[model samples]
Target: MTPQSIQKTWWKEAVVYQIYPASFLDSNGDGLGDIPGIISKVPYIKSLGVDAIWLSPIFASPQKDMGYDVADYRSIHAPYGTVADVQTLIDRLHANNIRILMDLVVNHTSDQHAWFKESRSSKSSPKRDWYIWRDPKYDALGNRKEPNNWKSIFGGSAWAFDEGTGQYYLALFLPSQPDLNWESAAMRQATHDDMRFWLDRGVDGFRIDSMNLMSKHPDLPDGKIVNPDEPYQSGAEFFASGPKMHDYIREIRTEVLDHYDVMTVGELGFTKDEQSVSEYVAKDRHELNMLFTGDIVDMDFGPNGKYERDDFHPRKIRTITNLWQNAMPKFDGWNTIYLDNHDSGRSLSRYASDAPEHRATAAKMLATYLMTLSGTPFMLAGQEIGMANLGKDYGADSYIDVEGRNYYNEVLETRGGDVGKMDDVLRELQLKSRDHGRLPMQWDNSPNAGFTVASAKPWMTINKDYTEWNVASQLDDPESIMAYWKQMLSLRKEHSDIFVYGSYTALEESVTGRWF
Candidate 1:
């Protein structure tokens, strides 16, 4: 298809910036980021030349898994500020001509959510079927056991035995985040209502979190053991692209999304097959407008998943990028382009060098790759200033992400709690932990990296090199990564037809260590 023949939409011709609120900036001297902090940076965000911002979850929560575990879908967390603050933020961004996409985490809710509370009140409660609950299995000697051997993406058993309800509830992530039952009409409607609430309040769209994991296998059978050393098995096969997955998404589109002129990007969890992804994003599918691919990020995953190391290879990324670039447009589907986000290590450290002498060049090179891609590019916060990963030398106490903490505990248990035996694991975590990306944004070289007042401690550690790599130092430099990103974004907007909708043709098939 020619570029002129492609469907034209605002999102297709735009770039998105993702903001992880907690680490973005602190407005009050409370050591935590608030909506007002984001409000204060409207001019800074506008200067980037991006079209929209994808704000991470800020709904009321117990914060067990940060704000992803929602206790009140319509309310904002107190640390982040009130609902009134979000309205002001929306108005400010819109006034700057920048759209906002809220993170929609409907696959699960905090165990503290009212629905979950009632669901756990009793086995016969009216809302008992609102969540995934199964009777406990018993051994030959009548020993009580979890319903299945499913392992969580965060680590450990996926099922948590609820003594009050006498059933095991599914929590694919943390125990505090119980998976919602999409089959329940009332529950699905409630989610749709929440979406409408945000849309009514002026949200331009949503980045649906874990969109593909909404439906689980009806039978809820035991998962196959994939790793010998791990106690639980991977249940992704039975849950990821389940029988009713597309049906549920289509229903959502028909019920809520179709009514609004909004952009929807679903986080396609554990799905890599071309056909599976196309079904979710193809124009005629009536589902998500686009989908984020998981293959490129998981390319370096070794036998033990993301924990074990595999030497980085550019050829793998080249193959995956080429496949998607050439394949997605064939089905009238689209992709969301990005290298790293709050969940992964910084791209400069993981994909290129973050060394003192090479960091700026590498960041510009990465920015060029993203801008020239045939999709809507999404830039992570602080990526343009050449932010990097915390190296292997940092101690274990610096790691605070749930996934990283769980891995640390697992390694300690396997190695008999020997601190000496934790060296290799610590090194791996240093390179791979999400905490590296969650560090406070380096606004300036001041104490606390200018993320908060010097007297107030930031929620997470500031990157030690923030003094050298920060926005204040690089914004005006003509050769800086931030400056280059600004130029590239303008270039992309100038020739959106070619850069965003143009066909891709690889010049070399056997290339090594270089992305064409």
Candidate 2:
């Protein structure tokens, strides 16, 4: 079909369901979810009427950032099955007429990855420049200091000391997830080659993880301090949307994505402006078809990186909606609309009136608000079951996220190790934390939430009320959240004018409530 006769970008009207493979389903007796397990759920995914499925990182990894820190891009992790299992999934999804979008995590790789291992072995190695490395600053007292004033997302310095080279390397996330040096031509070519491998395997598209953060300013200037009362500052400006980001993205598009009938959507973390969104996703740019913006998600956090208990007002929500609606015209590109993801808490608890009595109604309302907007709707696993955030009793030790653990320790340290105060802080953080959404999917009320075998202990705890709020139970109930989501997806697919290419207008914005 011609570009104009395409009606709209396939992704524009599509409802994309995101599956965190590790917690999705476990076909093996082992506690982890795998590709074969995901294959078994194809009919259920198809039943939702969604056009595509976006699986989170399933590549070989140490599970440091769940699966974002890739150790091998060409193969699947052993726990999640092999590359052949992925092919089976692709074939089955194609048979069901559903597309697949694999995660592309080019920003960093696990320190255990061969490239990083070689880069760190010696400063003179050929791969030395593959990852960012620099000399540490020394105080007059001769104490070693970090290369910059940047703070890691996991709560400490972004730089990690390398004993072998007596230098520091940048890691915006966990220490194991070393940032890649986009300045290295060899690194870019390698990443491009990896993308081609997936495309050749019939994968429909890619969801670029931390895509905007692939590059950093060459000067590496220290950004303005974020919190004077606190020790470290947020150095997001120093690395986000870096100097050669557009050029690097264009290269990837031209070399890999543009060669196939693929759709690319980037996850933009540090962007708040519309111009950048337009430049990255505009038609014919060969960069991306859309991007996931975090302005809505940032509202839950205070300026000091703490949870904002009293800041969630209707006016704030309206302002966010208006900014995106007015910034980019409907036809320019698409947006990925979501209230929850693998890295955020469940929407039912964080956004809805979490009281059990009101959860379903509020969940549907939130769904209607987002699904009708002019963009592709993305639903995280178990969101259709109206899943709430894990309760307070779910301690920090139970989660695998490095950032969650760091924040828990920071709270204890700040409180002079007061367990009670630390507990309260941890509870609040968990209420808004990412680990809540990473829990095992609620398939049935059976043991292990029907996600794995009876004797298996899942990688994380299954939701306590999974028996009442689960796919099997809700699928037969017409008024259930799952049914509502199915209806919404069906409507979106049938009514392309309003849900696909329609212009967005904020109807209300004030202290009482916000409407769009």
Candidate 3:
């Protein structure tokens, strides 16, 4: 079908590669990926024909949530290198004509952050209002209780008790990552200053982490109990799209983002509905240029959440994709097309067959879907080579992600120490854990998959299939998945007006699994 002509912008037509720093490569053989390692792979990234790179957080963090818990937004994480290293990286990538997007995690800060430190000090401290704090409620017997029945995304209570201040502070993800109080004008200003610190250093834009989570319910009310076995409840309804979400988003747009010509893709962490998503990225809204929606990724989630899986229906893919592709363009809101990233399991293993005979074919189909789609496409590092999830045989002990570990312990406790139940959860973890995506990138069939020196132990395990799946073997093979991806990218660029600006129409709107 002929594509309707639309306004052209570099961001709208770009193919972005997301790099999870710790897993990409190790420069000093210190078993961790650093800026120098990324710099070393510049030519390889360029070879992919991508126009931009979205780097996951490199900010100073305590490593509690794998760099999501920012300890100092202005400083670089020590293991990843220093501010000077980041500057050099920006220069190198820009010299190659590739724009860079830094991860912005402002929904919360590491409990160890200087601002959080002051906020937790004395109750009368000037920065006390910088974080969400509420006095404890008491029962008839005078026992203190949490402020609300909110469950953390990682499991357990969302509110963490602080002994120093005799109050509880909100930590929606992990206890070490305390939610920042966006209600405070001073806190908002500080966030803007931190953003400028990076934009001034030449970052092209930001991949805002949990951007929708910036504004939370003002009342801090109790959530309805969804699981009788667990005391806390899902707090998404109240916190996802708070009353002031759009107001705060527009404030950032005018005060910070609008000042620079940069790409802004907000992560709608909890806001999944089409209406809520359109409000943040609609051209008329004066907000973000695009957003990363979780609808496609979360389609298989069961009532019990990510760890519990529902039957995978092929129809959901068609329905979900069509819904976004058909609706967003009407409102002038753009979409981010991706199947997997630093969080979910690999696309090949989750959405397509990963068996030896069909892996290659499934991967090519995924690439075709991503490139031929109606919006910007994001390719995760190592995805080009068909990285599959570490199989269930790796065992529970191999899981390193904090969220998976928390869920493991929570499930164990709730089931009264049923080892079998824990084992079942482990099976699910093998398929859903973020750690699978964090496995070291497979560069070649060498010690440590050429990710680091032979003697240095990697921060995470290299996938066992690396010997056969590394890039060197496929780089020269014309029929390889990586090669096919390169072809698709070239085709997309050659027909930019059709692929990027094209209006989408589902050819199989009523197609179901039975039809296959």
| Model 1 lDDT tens row, 1-516 | 346558889999889999999989999988998789999999999999989999999999999998989999999999999999999999999999999999999999999999999999998999999999999999999999889999999988999999886889999999999999999999998899999999998999999899889999999888887778767999989999899999999998899988888999988888888888888988888788998876666666666678788867777778888999998879888878898888888878877899888988889889998999899899999997988988666899889999999989988988898889988778778777888778889999999888999999899888899889999998889988899999999999998878988899986764454444
- For model 2, residues 133-235, the per-residue Cα lDDT tens digits are 9999989999888888888888888889999999899999988999999999998998888999999999999999999998898988776875777656788
- Regions more than 4 Å wrong, model 2: 1-7, 228-231, 306-310, 393-400, 508-516
Better of 1 and 2 by TM-score: 1
lDDT of each: 0.89, 0.83, 0.89
Local accuracy of candidate 3 as per-residue lDDT tens digits, 218-335? 9988888777867899988888878888988899889998889899998888667888787888899998999888777776677768988675677888888889999887788888
Q: Which 10-residue window of candidate 1 scores lowest in summed lDDT?
A: 507-516
- Name the regions of candidate 1 deviating beyond 4 angstroms: 509-516
Give the local distance difference test score of model 3: 0.89
